[model samples]
Each structure stands twice: as structure tokens, then as C-alpha cells.
Target: MKNKTLLTVLSIIGMGLLLGWFILQMKPPHVNEKSTPSANQQAQTKTNSPEEKYIALTPEAQQKAGIRVKVAGPVQIKTVLELPGEIQFNENRVAHVVPRVEGVITAAYKHLGAPVEKGELIAVLESRELADLKSQYYTAIKRRELAQITFDREARLWREKVSAEQDYLAAKTALAEANIVVTAAAQRLLALGLTQDALDTIPQESQSKLSRYPIRAPFDGRVVRKHVVRGEAVKADAELFMIADLSTVWGTITVYTEDLNQVHLGQKVTVRSEELGLEATGTISYLGYLIDAQTRSTQAHVDIPNPEERWRPGLFVTVEVAEKKIPVPVAVAAEAIQTYRNQPVVFVQHGNGFEVRPITLGRRSGNGQWIEMVNGLSAGERYAADNSFVLKSELGEAMAPQ
Candidate 1:
């Protein structure tokens, strides 16, 4: 009876062990599932390389950051070249005033910075040479008058057969010689810049005023420089004053060798000065044919009208010249482009997220508000037009060395 009881207990334990093993086999195996990645990690993974540059941003986040998206479309872009420039006096309107005669400066009617009109007297001088010429003129006039009286009396006598013909002929020859001397003296005074009116008036005026020389302005302009002072002696060729017409000026740009082909006469240019808060538009008036050996550049002159004389000479400025206009199939706002690793890029909207896209750019508009896409973009593609810098910053923060 004890053996049979033990056997039964063993059989029951064996059945229980089998049942537990089968139940365990029937249950599912445990696995470690991965957690969801954060938005930054996902963006980094998308933009790991240039070929795969992309950013994943939620719609709500994009809206909160003021990111605006627009479709790339056709645009007309002008090829523009910007270069440093300077404002200068128009050489055509500049005058280097000279005395034209040796004299002692008696009075300076116009000083530096004084505006003068055409033909206005600017200075007065006393000349000894002029005094000598006036004396000669007066002596010649008196001699010619006496010769004329003699010739008239001799001619009357000969006509009436009262005087020898040889005597009358001699008197006529003397009168002709006297007239020649008078004409020669007058021409000498004319060469001294004495007008016919001045010559006629000098004979009627006092001898003391005959030596006075007046220097007149050549054009309507302001005296920029005065080289003579009162009581100073000056030579005939001495520069007395420098005058310039400020109504028009020049904006000169240095064009390099590579740019010589693009810049030409009559091309439109826009000039701006940041320091003076000034802007003006002009046309290219002149182009240098020879290049500067030292600078490897040539000059391009633009004529800028300054009716109010606001643009002063020697002011530094910038010039923008539009070389050509081209029609582009795809273009975007200039603000949409961003630099990544020295390459330009734009953000394209992909579903609810944004993808960073690399782009090749062509010519930019004259005003620099728009840019033409040479490649890596297509028309009708939606991109972040404004505030795209936000995505760039976020991506940069995520990719920074941690």
C-alpha cells in the first residue's frame, strides 16, 4: 500500500511540471521597442550631407516662427555689377583761372567759395607793360592826327596846282605810315585781352586808368581756390583762381579688366552714399580705353546732375551698373537664400515639414531684392520666402558639437 501511494504522487508531480512548461512555451516573447526620435534629431538625420540637406519642422512651429512659404516662379532679373566709386568735379566744367598778363594784383573782387557769373570781373591788377602800351597808343594817335592834317592840306594845294605833286605824294605816304603804326599798336593791345570796347574807352578815359587790368570769370561757377592776394605780383600764366560748376558732377568707378567688356557708354548706373544718405541715377558718359597697369583697372565715368549742388566732390560712393536683363524660369526672394558651408540654400516645404535645398544662383536683380536660380530648383516649388533664417539657426544649433 505505501509503494502504490508514492508512485501516484510522483505521477502527479510529473504532470504538473509538463503543464507548466507547455504554458510557458505558449506565452509571447518579450522585445525592447525603440523610442520616438525628437524633432532636432530627425532634422539632422535628413540633412546629414549636401545631397540630403533637409529640415523637418512641424507646421505649428513654422507658423509660430513667422516662416512664410511661396512658390518659385518666373522673374526678370538684371545682371548687375557693384563697385566702389568716388564723386569728382566734372573736368569739362572746371576752369584754371590765369591772369593772362604780368601785373600787380590791386583788388580781389571774388574770394574763395564766392559764386560768380560769366564775364563777371573777379580781380583787378596794375600793369607797367599796359601803361607803356597805352602811352605808345596815345603818341601814335597824335602823330596820325598831325599826318592826316598835313596830307589834307597838301592834297588841296596840289589839286589847285599851288603845290608840287612830289610834296603831296610825300605827305600822303606819311599819312599811310602813321595809320599803319596806329593799327599795329591797337592790335598789340587786343592781343592783351583788351576788347574793342575797352580800347575805345581807354583813349577817352584818364591816363591813370589806362594801366588797370580786370580779370573776368570764364563761366558761371564758384571759386574753389584763390592763389593771389592783394598787392601780390603775378605773371601772365600764373593760376589766379580755380572755378568749378557744381551743377553737374562725375561719379567715377574703377572697372577691372574682366569687367571691361560689360561696361560701356550710355549704360545706366545708380550711385549711393551711405554716409550722406544720398542716392542718384546717371548714365555712363565716358569709358577709359587704357587699363591702369598698377591697379589693373580702368575708369568708368558717370554724369550725375546736381542742380542743388548736394553731391560734393571727393565724397565716397558705390555704383551699381545693370549690364543685361534675362528671363529666368525659376526665381525666389533674395531673403529666402541662406549660406550653408559657403553654399547657397533655400528651404522647401515638404508636406507639413520643411526640407533644406541646395541651389545654384545666376544673376541677381538690379535692386538685389530677387535672385535667379540657375539650377537645383524648379518652378512651382514652394519655398520659405521670408524668415528662412530661423530654420538655418535651428539646424545649426542641432548640428553643433555637443
Candidate 2:
């Protein structure tokens, strides 16, 4: 019975050894730690393998891929074209009020910004020259009266043959020459702005003769500039007042040479002012023949109505000139554009990756949202529509010196 029990225990131990050997060899033949897992290898009852190298995932890249993409599309560029400039006055309508004769400015009746009408008295001038002319006129008038009385007597004598014809002719010549003298003196007084009524009053009020000259406003306008004061000597034809008709002022549109073609005479223009929040409608009145040397721009002038006197001569304002529109080729979105050092590139998607391409830009469309391309990008072409700037940075880092 002991020999039979020992035989049974040895038999059980032998079975256990056989089972362990089979389990060890059951792994696929030639299968090793270095081998890549095949489709059939994963089907094994128990197996462990390292991941494939090409398909290996970095933590950073995995996190990036898991994040939601920012959705973007083409936004057309248009409007809000801010052309800079200042306001100006109408050159044709503006006028300067100056004194006609040299004199001392005795009065400053008009304020610097006061409104005045045509022929309204502005100031008075005390002039010695004017007084001298008046004196000459008074002397000539008295001499002319005496000559007339003498001529009447000579005519009566000639008609009765009581005197010789030569005697009468001599008197006639003397009277004629005296009249010419009177005429010359009268012209001097007229040149000095002596009115007919003033001349008549001069002889009766000879003792009241004075040296004052009245200056009148030449036109209906507001006094924008003043160059005279009481007791100040004013020169002849010197600009004492810069009077301007603010009823209408200039709204100048300074368009570049490239945009000059878009404007024409009589084109409707709208002008707005910030000071008074006033809007004035005007028409293109003049187109400048020459371009500004500094700005390289041409001025197109519009005549704006300013009945409320809100828009003054020098207030800065804006002019909106509608330009002609034209269609152009544009790459739908800004995301397609990438920069490579000094050049612009577009990442055109190819297969599963992308390739950078250089492109030329044209006029801005969607005002600035989408830029028009002169060359390179095309419609309906698949491209890296987002994160193009990221690709640009990568290209820069790659091209850096080692």
C-alpha cells in the first residue's frame, strides 16, 4: 500500500511539470519583447507589448488635440476708410476789408467777431491828407465863382460891341483856364471820398473842416481778423479786417491721386462737424488742378451751407466722398495668411498635412476682415484656415541658426 501511494504522488508531480512547460512554450514561436504586436498577437489569451514608435503620443500633443478648435471664417473687409484732413473756408467767397486811404484809425465800431452788412460803417480815420484835399476844393470853388462873374460881364460887352473881340476872347480864355483849375481840385476831393453833400456843407461850415475819413464794411460777413485799433496809423489799402461770408463755407475733400478719378464736378458730398454736431449737404464746387506736394493729394472742394453760422472759417471738419466700387479676388479668411520672415505665406492643406505658399495682397476688402489676394490663394481650396500664425512661428524657429 505504501509503494502504491508513493507512485501516485510522483505521477502528480510529473503532470504539474508537463503543464508548466506547455504554458511557457504556448507563446507564438519567435515572439519576443522587441517584436511589434500583430493582429493575431492581440488575440492571444495572455500577452503584454510596448507601443509602436510611429504611433507614440507625447503628452503635449495629446492635450492639444483634445482641445476644441476655434471656429473662424472669411469676414469681408469694407467701410470705415478713415482719410485724414482738416476743414477750410471757401476761397472764392472770403474777402478782406482794407482801408482805401492812409490815416489814423479813430474808431473801432465793429467787434472782432461782429457780423456786418455791405456799406455798414466799420471805423473812422483821422487823415491830414483828406483835410488838405478839402481845402484845395474850397479854394477852387471860390475862384471859379469869381471867374464866372467876370465872364458874364465880358459876354455883355461883346454882344453890344462896346469892347474889342480880342478883349472878350482874352477874358473867355482866362475864365476857361480857371474852370479847368477848379475841375482838377474837385477831382482831388472826390478821390478822397468827399461826398456831394459833404462838399456842399464844407463851404458853409468852413470853420468846421476836419480830417476824418469813414471806413465802411465792403461786404456782408463776419470779421475773422482785425488789424486796426483806435489811434493807430493805418496804411493805404492795408488789410485791417479779414471779413468772411460764413453763410457758406468750404468742406474740402483731400483725395489721394489714386482716388482722384472717383470724384467729379457737382457730385453730392456730406460734411459733418463735431463742435456743433451739424451736418451740411453740399455739391462738389471745384476740383484742384494741382496735387499737394507734401501729401501727394488733390483737393476736391464742396460748397456747404452754414446759415446758422455754426461752421466757421477755420473749424476742422470731415468730408465723406463716396468712391467707386469694384470687385476683386480675395482669400475668404485671414487665417489663410501666414508670414515667413519677410514674406507672406498661405498654408494650403494637402493630403493629411499642409504646405506653405507665398501670396500677393491686393486692396483690402470686408474693410479689413478679409484681404484680397493678387496671386497664390484661390476659392474653394482646402487650407489651414486657423492657427496659420502658429505655423509661421514654427517656420521661423526651424530656420533659426543652429
Give lDDT tens digits, candidate 2, residues 85-182. 45576777677776667888879899888998987999888788777777777788888788788778888999999888887888788788888987
Candidate 2: misplaced stretches above 4 Å?
1-85, 167-179, 192-197, 274-276, 292-294, 323-402
* lDDT tens digits by residue: candidate 1, 1-402: 999999999999999999999998895865544366778877777657654556778888988999999999999888778888999999999999887789999999988899999999999999988888878988899899999999999999999999999999999999999999999999989888788888777668787898899889989999999999999999989999999999999999999999888888998889999999999999999999888899999998999999999999999999988778889899999999999888899988888777778899987898888899989889999999889999889778766789
User: What TM-score should be assigned to candidate 2?
Assistant: 0.57
Q: Relative to the unseen true structure, what is the C-alpha lDDT of residue 376 in candidate 2, on a scale of 0 to 100?
A: 76
Model 2, position 26, has a per-residue lDDT of: 90
User: What are the clashing pairs of model 2?
Assistant: 76-366, 77-365, 77-366, 77-367, 77-368, 78-366, 78-367
Model 2 lDDT, residue 99, Cα = 64
* Candidate 1, superposed: residue stretches over 4 Å from native: 1-29, 35-70, 83-85, 255-257, 274-277, 289-300, 338-360, 374-377, 382-402
Please give each candidate's TM-score.
0.74, 0.57
TM-score, candidate number 1: 0.74
Scored by CA lDDT, what does every candidate get? Answer: 0.90, 0.69
